[model samples]
Target: MPQATKLSAPTAAPTPALPVRGQTDHLRLIAEMTREFTASHDYQTIAHSALERITRYIGAEAASLFLLTDNGETLACSACYGPVDITGLRISAKTGVVGRAVQTREGSMVRDVSEDADFGASVDAKTGFTTRSLLVAPLNIGQDCLGAIEIINRVDGDGLFEADDLVLLETLARAAALAINNYRLTEQIVQQERERHELELAAEIQRDLLPQPSSREFPIHGINIPARSVSGDFFDIMTLPDGRIWFNVGDVSGKGMNAALLMAKTSSLFRCLAKSAEHPGQLLNAINSELCETNSRGMFVTMVGGLFDPATGRLTLTNAGHEPPLHFDLRTERFTPIPADGPPLGIMPGIAGSDGYAVTEIDLAGGMLYVFTDGLTEATTFGGGMLGIDGARALIRDHAEESPDIRLKSISGAVKLPGQSLRDDLTLLVVEDMMTARAASMPPPRLEAMSTDGEILRLRVPARPDRLKLIRAAVEQAAKYCEATEAWTFDLTMAVDEACQNIIRHAYGNRPDAGDIVVDFIRRGDCMEVHLMDFAEPVDPSKVKSRDLSEVRPGGLGVHLIKSVCDEAQFVPPPPGIGNLFKLTKRLPSKLQ
Candidate 1:
């Protein structure tokens, strides 16, 4: 054996002096090596294959491949084919002959390691292998140093690396750089796909926690739109077992996955606690305490909650540092805000500086209560202008006369307009009182001849405030004729009086000259039914809201009283030619039955 000789020593010039046949043979071998580099995508496989190809081409005994880490501070040996296994080793990208090649973006050759200043003896010192001639090439792509490849002690031909070897190794390193970069890009794409799938699942779970819009008893409707894959805002409305409706809207402090998780927790706590809680304040107190204890992220919630009693037409509400709700007044055709009275949830437990959560009551005479998160008010227009409080009020007023369904659609459409970007989650809820509304929009009574078979009493009186006495008296007499109890008679009379007064005052707008108010007392199979009709201007159903009874109010208690006394009190829209038809049905006891 010729000592397994390599071609010349590393002291050779840039272009080696070689015979025509040898130079041609080197070119053919390099073409085959380039094909190997383009064939594989596995990083380790590519690095291992490059090391074997480069070492064999230069007739060297050992080789190693190092790649830069993501942080760019160090290079990690990804593969090795040498006397000692140095795989998985890490070093600074500023270290030995490999570092010099990477730093200068060129290749280097050392004829003798003992005489070379850049030779790092750490590898040889550990492996106890004597070093001699070697070649180093930087794995570079577009001026970026990915890493380097090194070939050690030549064992063939002249036992040294030549200038020709330098040229071949540098070319091979360029191809290896591309393969590494491709593998890195593929890993990044896979990671992003996994995160996207998780967000979608979170969005579904959040939507399931929401209460569906299917309550006709309260005529409640709303919509929620998220700025991202998940939302930080939510609205909930549930009719309690006791015929009372509880509704609330909340906004978390942030957006994305973290905010979505917090929103779900807040909403779940509300649904669980609101079932047994009596007042809006009590519900808020329990919810605030629960959230403060488990909330480690320090995120807070701004919320507005309300309880509506359809029987009494009373709405009790609590606002916890949230945007004020827009009150659409049908009488005045204006919008008023229900301001917040306490701080937001998770802002330090119980109401700050106050004894407890302050409850605000409103006797919805005939108006709509519109509640929403700040996302609606803070939304930006195409011109980059915010839809401030005033803008929100104006928008609600514009659709004040619309039905709940249309109103919700219009609001959602305005907030999520085409080509406009949403910066936060949006939520809106609307509650309306249609009884008072139907009374104000009375038409003339349709009097052809209702079956008089069970007619107990019938009276046609002038629609005047003074004649309310006659209406009540007639109702009391009819109750007595039907053998009704004292309690039944009193409640019927009072309920009849309220219905007539609401007609004379609100329906006719206190104009006695409007028309006659028809009062009919009919006895059905097992109940007493009274039908009253008044001719007046048709009222917008969305404008009627009962007055708040907690306050020392002088008037507006008539509708609340009638609804409380009558088992079934509803404003029947006049059929065709009829005015506002007010029907009050009360079940009679066995004696009257």
Candidate 2:
């Protein structure tokens, strides 16, 4: 419109070129600085060495490297090659010429400090040094500015920094920035690796603190699983000389390393104190007092501790702000929940009061007691739902008939999905009342001769399949002593073999360490009676039904075969200290009698 005033592109200012000698010297100096930076990994060492070389190359009387603090509000002099030794000096990030260079990500050349508004005279005043000229180059990588390098009082001709000096400083700043960045990244990687290794070691130590899995026939069993590299949940079982078992399940308030450390401390205290403490209440009181003395983080522990007498099927429990334990009755298939009675441990020295945590006495008559952390209840199921208390009860019922070891596995496996992270740490414990079950199932003792009266043969052997042959041999010899025919002896031997096989497989759950079996062959009057005894968990006779012979299967035939060969086979009341007593009777021929 207004004659379209001819627009012309403005010509860019030409970059200043260095003299031939000066260019060569700069290239050599850059090469030397690169080699020096590449050879060192220590931050302070590289910074100090580079600062000295840079001051000499730039022909400056003194130089300092300033790095931004983590908060970016202040600048710290990390290294210096100056007479004043300004290392560790601090200043506001926006107060000086060096700050401006870093903030603007550019280089500055001040011919006279008096003419510069950003120059701070305070440092010179404090150190008793006079500053007339200065140059600053920002240490930058891409869009990030780490800090700046400051050079003061040029020693060369004219004693003033020029455009070429600023350019050279900027080039040197880039190399230094790259070296610092690389060092920081490498340090981070090394720190992470070290932390990972330490965590693995800690996990191993934690595992060692837990008791080994108990025998399947034992009255108590427990399991623990961690959500991360470490767990905040723990369980322990220790049997006293009098057959009373001390057991506990605990959960810390938080997670990660802190929680794990607390769990370890609490568990160790329980094990160490429970040995002398007469009851669960007293034991928990002592543990609580100890924790309160050193629990500076305000963390607490929720736990359930119990003292169980297997002989009487009695459990005295103390709950410290933990989830209620479910007492499952085998006969009625119902759960009786025992709720917490006190605040969590570590809250206060006398949180439980003078009497300590209240005790709940329970009679687990032929049933089970289940104690667990909230993690099990909050676990995600395959259906994408949380396994609440009801779900946990269902899992228990489903695996109730299994051995304690197998039952724990089944219950935990249902919620521990593959490739999925758990929401929290999980732990579970079970206390079975085998004594009550044995008492209920045992029949009255018969008024027959004792085993010592007509003990034709008596032998004790480990409950293993390989040891069954010894029982067969002893039975055969006992039949001969009673003057029975070869046919009669063979039949008794086969029956005894089948009976012993049942004891090894069913009574002991085929475990190698499951106590032993004691057999007694007695010839009383006209009848020869054989008695077999085991110390395993009592077997319910009603559940030991013989399968139909018509069905073809690999197993479920031992009981049928034993009953077929004997005239009468039944379970009788065992003597004191015995779990089960099985008797087999056969009337000898008249001639032998």
Candidate 3:
């Protein structure tokens, strides 16, 4: 049965005024209690003091304060001056004199309790006290009957209980109820602390368990985000030697600690393979073999891995049922996708190998690449409608010409609403081209195999902090060089700004004290791609893995803007801090800046 609320009726009546000598003293006492005790924040302490004070102030032999619990069915004695055991006694708000007054919202007084039908003398019987004049009244505030207050056996000169006495007791009851209510609120606050603490602990553990970033003067990057207190999505970056970079992003099928732990193992193993210099397909095979043996929960991970050559700006990648990444052509100012095949990790590890992997190839021919988990596209609005793939792609196109910060703000701002909660996680990545990046003395490994419309300008630059500006200037210049119209130049300029800033901020993270970054720009026959190679720190894109940005913030704003501004962005981590490549590709003849 649903519990009844305390009387939701008229407000408590003020005590009736009467002509009496001690009335002034009684009023003063009541006022003092209200100002000093009831006004204090602690309610229970004041309640006890109020009853003890009423006993002495009113010249009553005994005083009792009954409080109604939230359910209102029981009125328990909260404080009693005459007898301590009265604290445990319960009164029914339905039948007892106190109950009837509280339920009916009335006040009753029995000058001689034994002669009054409403008076119950059992309390006096238990205490060996004679029946005497008394006052019982409901303690009400607003519409709630908090309980009742009673004064028994007036002393120090009293001819029966006068009307003035009833007035005084009523004043005391009002103050008492307010105090009691505050005490109940405090109790609720104390309980919430425990739950909040646990959530904090869980959130901390989830963050701590993620992969430790690899700080190397190489090319590779990562991102991650937890869906809840713990995350099911993660990524890792490890740079090997010989211009080879290794990185992977993956998401567990479920959420929470178990998925987080599973993500930890996958990330660790994937990063550990940095020593092997394995190709994308080979690495997935090895990891799948391990997961096939250990993934007892039957859960799987949608994963993607890649090996990037900073010198060549070539990314050899393998995808495990993850999203099909975008490939943008700077020359044509058009976009498409580079798809990979294989099941999610742990879904029969050997499945892809038995069937042969479906590999999609694209030339980072001065262009961009983008990869993401379902979280980004699957994020829902407050109205329960998902942003979906079309929304994510449309955002990219709409702001493809805006500044990175503006683009980030636009995408985030598009979803802002009060009091709405995100239903899932969203994670996305963009790899931009850093124009004027040129490095000499490289082997010609089939440049013709790559296709570009003609906006690409590939260069290889030495690793130096001062040279970063040169790369940025070169990109700005390249934008002017390739654009058929001035409008297209501004669009490319924003892409250049975002890509260079990311290479400086995300890749180097403002660590000028460390070392400088290397840059390369590849202008294909069809489109232009800018490549920024750094040997700073590589973040696992998985860190920004799965978060529901649809409703609220689960991560930072940079990557979101990168996705919105550039046609494509891809991260490639090379070995020995050798290659940390940031590729940004913009389709030529694009929208105005």
Candidate 4:
């Protein structure tokens, strides 16, 4: 057996396999290069670092990155690794595996590359090294193929390149693709932000062009404070023929610019239709329908429209879900608030409550009629309580005598002194005195059929524009005593204080519960006579001027003042069909010389 062992051909020791344990650490270090490259804003730093990492990780004898030109067919080396020269390695994408990988969108391998027919000889001739192996990967992102990465002549002994070596080189290609992608995305974001800034600036300019609220004035006041940069509260008053004051007050739901836009539109519509000779009910209905057609945003307006009738001391009103109005009767010191009868505007279409709305007839007497947006009452009190309609009415009662300008200022001061923001737009409008309205269209009074019958005490009270408080107190006192005040004069002209109280006591024989009285005015040959008819027992004319003047008392003194100053005082009693009535007379005061 020993002799049979033939000497085999001497075999070379197998090439020692390279140690690859620390290779993972080298990979992490290489991965970090891409992270740093992408993080950098400067192109030079990114290019320099990417080249250094490639040369170290692959142990390349010489390596260089050629950045593709816009045409993708040609590339100029950007970062280089080698001792030969600092100038870049230049290449055309069509010449080598670098070109083939870019064109095919895949990796390429070369072993014994000089033997391959398609391999180029120029890079080999310049570097003066026989290329043993080569690895190449396209550095493409999506359809954009950006040249390729190539490593040549590995430092370690090798046959065909190891599978892991090809993998590591391909991984490096992906990082390069991502870095290029990041730069393009950042540029796009910057462009978009600039456009957004331009739009915001334009919006600011439009906000400034609209009118600021504190600038207008008129017979009927307007207030349009805003809850935000803009709001929905709006009020407008326009004068019409024959001493009629046409006015509109409303509040729209919601806030800010949309609300402001709608308010502007509604106010403009009112002004355009201000001259429409329609009844207030009809007018409001028309406005509601128009707004409903255009108010597609589901917003509504609570409004109050008024047509002032000065001659009749009446105001015809139509309500649209607004708060009830506070009416102060100057003749009785009493308040009668007209309530809501219609829904908020723009709720339904042509069918609206404003059409079926009954006109509220009110007498402003000597006191002003204060109409306001709910914002005033709905405001927060300093105590963190809500100031409701009662609070607003009380404030009006306190300032009923002040002029509209002064009263409005008072309201502003009271709210602001407590450091409160008027959260909603608060507004107030006033009609100072309703009496001086043109009364010329009124027909002359026809005197009651002369009863040449009994004694009748008549009193004629003129419109007391200045004596609101006095007039109200007297009317209330007479009501408590159950006496009716009439409209006749003891004199040819008015003697309000004397005649009113006098007729209240004398006509009904000072009966506290007397019913209503009628005053008839008759003018014959410059002598105007007032007649009052009643069903109470007939009065004695001889005793009509006599009253017990013994002691000063609060009760009977009103009659004494009446007879002393008035031209005639007659008390009518006990007529078959008529109830108690009073006759009063007055002469116009002459101008002093």
Supply candidate 2's per-residue lDDT for 127. 77
Clashing pairs in 2: none
TM-score of 3: 0.48
Better of 2 and 3 by TM-score: 2
The positional error of residue 584 in candidate 3, measured at the CA in angstroms, is: 19
Tell me the tens digit of each residue's lDDT in model 3 across 324-382.
Answer: 77765543446787675777878785788674455454566545555667766777654
The TM-score values for the models, in the order shown, are 0.66, 0.71, 0.48, 0.45
| Candidate 4 Cα misplacement greater than 4 A, ranges | 1-219, 353-357, 437-593
What C-alpha RMSD separates each model from the true structure? 14.2, 14.0, 16.4, 19.6
Order of all candidates by TM-score, from best down to worst? 2, 1, 3, 4
TM-score winner between candidates 1 and 3: 1
Give the alpha carbon lDDT tens digit for every residue of 55-90 in model 2: 877777678999999687889999987566789999
Residue 15 C-alpha lDDT in model 2: 21
Q: Write the per-residue lDDT of candidate 1 for residues 319-379, one digit (tens) a residue.
A: 9989998777553456778999988897677754556788999966456788998888888
Candidate 2 matches the true fold with a TM-score of 0.71
Note the clash tally of each candidate: 29, 0, 86, 25
Q: Give the Cα lDDT of each candidate.
A: 0.76, 0.83, 0.62, 0.59
